[model samples]
Target: VGTLTFKDAPSMVTEFAAVMKKMASYKHSIGTGDTNATDETRVVDGKIYLIINPVNYYDIVARLTIQNANGVFVTNMPFISPDHIIQSVDVPVNKLIVFIENGYDATQSQPEKISEYKETFAMKRATLYAIDMLGNGKPVDNYAAQVYDIAIPTSGGSGE
Candidate 1:
């Protein structure tokens, strides 16, 4: 994990908008071997990289997405298991990282939003973030009752 210094919220928001415009032409990839695969972790002239480590409780599978503050969808990673990490490269700064409770049925009408974090990431830094659920025992149907937290790993910390 890299050390990150928080930028002023107002300035960061402006910068994020500009960066998003610049990134309009860039594409993102999922796994290796895709023709359109773009290495997000590669040091770009004006972008940041993020690695999200989601810690699940009660052996639940988490569905996560990244969205801008205006609720615009950026990207999503479905079915992230416990302790699994997802890397997003050249991401726009000051976006919201959201986690939704998994609804096994593919045809389910709506998925519930359990937790979210609005972050202003440091430029040129590959930052590691951990999202964790807080509660004891198994979860019930009302996922909104559950609490979640997002944090940066400390020095030498694995965020386990």
Candidate 2:
């Protein structure tokens, strides 16, 4: 996990929002290979790397695509078994990284077909709900539930 710090919050947010709006209409990279980045790779202050460590267990397979600030496709890295780490070829600061949930072939050395990545269009549009029941057949609903997004890329069980 990593944190982002900005000297000018409002300015940076404004700039980031502008870029994201353009990205909404852009196409992303998928599968294994070089990349599908059509625009110039954006420059950032630093780089973004991922460190995945399993607790009390181990993972078998993992993969995801990283897009740079200039709307460039960086890499579709694959993490195989145990613990793994992936570093983006291009630095990512005012960029977007989509953790794909489906549709990419990992069988061949090079992917024949690619799939789309996951994205969120709106903010705060998601809500959490907590439901509780009393012994006397009374139901209590507290909409104050808080949810977190944890992206842990793992393979489907074990390989035969």
Name the top TM-score candidate.
2
| All candidates: TM-score | 0.18, 0.20
Enumerate residue pairs that collide in model 1: 40-89
Off by over 4 Å in 2: 1-5, 27-107, 110-160
Clashes in model 2: which pairs? 42-70
* lDDT string, candidate 1, 57-101, tens digits: 211112233467999854332222323333334322322232233
**Global fold similarity of model 1 (TM-score):** 0.18
- Clash total of candidate 1: 1
The most accurate candidate by lDDT is: 1
